[model samples]
Target chain A: MAKNTSLYEKHLAAGGKMVDFAGWEMPIHYGSQLEEHHQVRRDAGIFDVSHMTIIDLSGREVRGFLQKLLANDVNRLKKKGKALYSCMLNEKAGVIDDLIIYYMHDDWYRMIVNAATRNKDLTWIEKQAQNFEINIDERPDLAMLAVQGPNAREKAHKALGNKILAAQDLTPFFAVDCGEIFVGRTGYTGEDGYEIVLPSQQVPQLWDDLLTAGIEPIGLGARDTLRLEAGMNLYGQDMDESTNPLESGLAWTIAWQPEDRDFIGRGVLQKLRDSGPNNKLVGLVLQERGVLRNHQKVIVDGVGEGEITSGSFSPTLKCAIALARVPAQTEDQCHVEIRGEKRSAKVVKPSFVRFGQSCID
Target chain B: MSNVPDNLKYTKTHEWIRQESDGTLTIGVTDHAQGLLGDMVFVEVPDVDANFNSGDDCAVVESVKAASDVYCPVSGEITETNEALADTPEMVNNDPFGDGWLFKLRPTDPNEISTLLDANGYQEIIAEDSH
Candidate 1:
């Protein structure tokens, strides 16, 4: 049997189609997934993200440990509540997981990782911490909700009540501790929103309150479509332990400056940088009526073949879009094999939609 | 919460059949089928004039979450297919019983549909599946 989140009963009450995801019983959709996707784009929507893993690190050597463990530089987060997105890589430069790290205090940092990667990530982090004196506290008692859209901030403010003022001045990628809840101005969808991390026991009340506040309850189906429209990569689908950040459209997250910082995969990354990565991840927009899907072969006419990592019917764009890993020499026009027939697609930057607007022409 | 018309015949695989006076029959996925599949993104109907026996996979309905095959409930030759679904597949979810009819077929044996289940029988299947 799959484990249930704190809001599982509430989701069932609201007509969510329950499905098993990452060993957890989660909602795939409440009713119409297309409507839910439009809800987030046009107005406010809430997502139950309690399945994501949260770990807190507190120690004198926390910053040093992070600098060596993550591909991104944590030193850039000088101000409190600042957050940085980084990828944890193995010694071979293969990506273990991509996560957001928030600097809470001089000795404390909070990181939220993907749900499916929790056990492996914890094991890897614990093994690495043996050399440094740090405490890794996995906060299973926390339940998360992401309220996102064009008017999400204002609606979240209204729903949160007393914590409104403290969260008002928060900018993107910043977080604030509002007594019992931690509100971060971050989201997976390409929309403005707040991700609230609070005690698990209090989650059902918050979910009901958000629903009463006129926020629609979105599920994992729309969440996937929304994130894919934003060109965000899903951990296991887009890249995994066998894939590296350089080839996964996450090269920008790797900070290679200050030459001697020496992050975990710095050596292999530097070598790849010097020799150049053979494959690059790009966006694909189907010019025809077919829906693009994962594992489809991407045939760049003159160049070599590639494969689609994540693909979906973009509700916002009214068409299909995909993220594909193609040869470095691949250009604008390519053909994707759908069911046996080769269909033409246009290659562009990885983003298709952001802030409810189409990014590609 | 799905509508099951009393006059139609149903299949264990979730398809519905409506016999026509012109010796042809219309077929579509039931309301319960569309409800379970969520929003329909694409529907791949079998080509007109294709022949199939009962239980043969004849069409596909794809939602955002998954793709499911629609099997033929009775042996027939496909006379027509709903082409409008190529652009607006949501019709299946919006009006599954009427405008969302997937295909039409001329029956090889008009009596073959008697072996299929009635609405009450289909409801029983759905109710059991729900549990």
Candidate 2:
């Protein structure tokens, strides 16, 4: 049986159509997914993301341990409540998982990882921590809600009540400890919002509060489209333990500077970087009527064939968009094999929509 | 909470059928089917005059997350296709029963309709599947 989040009943009450996702009974959509996508772009929307694993690492050697464990450098997070998005890679330089770590104190840090990758990620992190003295504390007692949109911040402020002042001045990519709830000004959707982590008992109340504050609950269906539009890669679909970050449109997330910092998979990644990646992750925009879908074959004439990692119709852009891994030489245009028929698509930067605006031409 | 009209018949795969006055039949997906698929970004309506056997994949319903095949509920020749859906696919989601009718067909054998499901039977199937 799939596990239920604290707000499962609330989801049912809101007419959510529940489905199993990553061993959790989650809502795929409450009603119309396109409308939910629009809601997050134009107004406020909330999501029950409590299935994500939260690990709190605290020890004197946490910083050093994180530096060696993550592909991205944690040294950049100088201020308190600052967050860093990094990928944990294997010895072969393949991504184990991508996660966000918040620096709360010198000896304490909070990490949030994907729900589907929780078990593997915990095993990997624990295995790596054997050489150092640090605590890997997974917080299952917490529930998370992502409140997102252009109007999300103000609505979240209204719902949070006493914690308003603490979160009011928070900058993007920053977080603040608001006594009972930890508010991070970050989200998967290409919108301004807060991902609040609080006690499981507080979740239902907060969900109702957000609803009362005029924020509607969005589901996983819209979440996937929103993230795909933002050019964010999903684990398992985009890349897995077999694909490296260089070929996965995540080279920017890799901290290659300060050559002395020998993080996990550094040597292999550096070699791959020197030789250059043969396949590249690029964006595809279908100008016509068809919707782009995952696993579709991307044919670039004279160049090697590629596969779509994540693809969907952009509710904001009103067209089909996808992230595909194709040959480095592939440019300008490509043909996607849909139902055995080759359809033309324009190749551009992976990001198609951000902040309710079209990032594509 | 999905609507199932009592006047029309349904198939196990969630397609709805309305017997027209001309003896031809209008076929579209049910509200339950549309609800399951989410928003209809595109609908690949079967070509007019196309003939199909029962259980054949006649048309496709593409949503944001997935593409599902709309099977031939009853063997028929496609008499007409919904042209409006080409420009406004959301008709499948907005008004699935009326304007969203995918095609009109003249059945090979009219008695084949009795073998399919009624609205109550279809609701039972949906309710069972939800569990």
Candidate 3:
């Protein structure tokens, strides 16, 4: 049997097509995925992200524990409610999971990891924390909602009522606490929005209030296209236990400034950083009428070969775009083998769209 | 429940066929198939005059998330395809029985029609499959 979120009944009432997602029965779409995708870019949309795993860590050595567990430095987050995105790596420099860490204080911090990788991520985090004086507790009682789009903030504020005032003026990458609710000014979609975490029991009311506010309910379908168009990497698809951050277009997330910070897999990453990653993740725009799909072969002429990690039709760009792992020397153009035919594609920066605008040139 | 027009015939693989006055069979994925596929982004229609054996892979339909192969329901030579789908593949979701027809083919074995499922039989197939 699949797990159900607090909004499962609401999803059924709203005509959502329920499907199994990471062991949870989630909505794939309400009526049409394309329309939902467009709605987020044009207006605002809400998604039930409660299935994502949230873990809380508190102790005298919380800061030190995170510094050693995550590849990104938490020392930069001096202010409370500041969030950092980092890839939790294994000893071989392979990515275990990519997640967001929200700083509440030196002793108390919250981390949200992917749903599919919950078991392993927890085991890994717990194993790393045994030596240090820390308490790692999973917050299964919490529910998370991501309200994203150009007008996402206003609509979310309207749905959330007075509690949103604390998050109203939040800058990007910052989070705020209003009693029992926590709002992070960050999202997977490249749109301005808030990822609100609250008590699971209180989510149904918020979900209904957001619907009454005219914010469309986005399903997992549109959630994927939106993220792909934004050039964001999906955990299992873009990178996994077999891949590392340097080759996954996540080199920017690594904080190597303080060489003394001996995080997990630091030595391997340091060697790769100096030698440079041989394969790079890049964006591909189909020069013809075709949909780019994952695992498709990509051939870089006279250079090398590669494969698409995440590919989809970008409703925002009105064309097919994909993120491909190709030989780092590839430039300007390549070809994707779709079916039995080789189609031309243009290579560009991994980010295809951002802030409701096409970032492609 | 999916709409299964009484006038058409369906295959076990979720394709609907309608025999035109010219004896050419028009084929497309069933309504339930399109609904399962969500929204369509692109369709690769088979070329005119292309010949295929029954159950042979002919064209492709891609939704935003994945691609599915469209199989030829019966052996025939392709007569026409829905060119409009090249620009607007959502026709598959909007009118899977009408404007969304994938291709038209002249049947080589007209007797094969008797082996195809009627609306009721096709409905049962979808129902049992879901169970």
lDDT of 3 by residue, A193-247 (tens): 9999999999999999988988999999999999999999999999998989999
Q: What is the DockQ of each candidate?
A: 0.67, 0.76, 0.82
C-alpha DockQ for predicted model 3: 0.82
Q: Give the clashing residue pairs of candidate 3, or none.
A: none
Off by over 4 Å in 3: none
True contacts kept of 1: 0.65
Q: What residue runs in model 2 are displaced by over 4 Å at the alpha carbon?
A: B108-115, B118-124
Candidate 2 per-residue lDDT, tens place, A49-144, comes to: 999999999998999999999999999899999999999999999999999999999988999999999999999999999989899999999999
> What would the per-residue lDDT of candidate 3 be over residues B40-130, giving only the tens digit for each residue?
9889999999999999999999888678998898899999999999988999999999899999999999998888999999989999989
lDDT of 2 at A69: 97
lDDT of candidate 3 at residue A315, scale 0 to 100: 89
Candidate 2 residue lDDT tens string, B53-127: 989989988988789999988899999999889878899999999999999989999999899898899999999
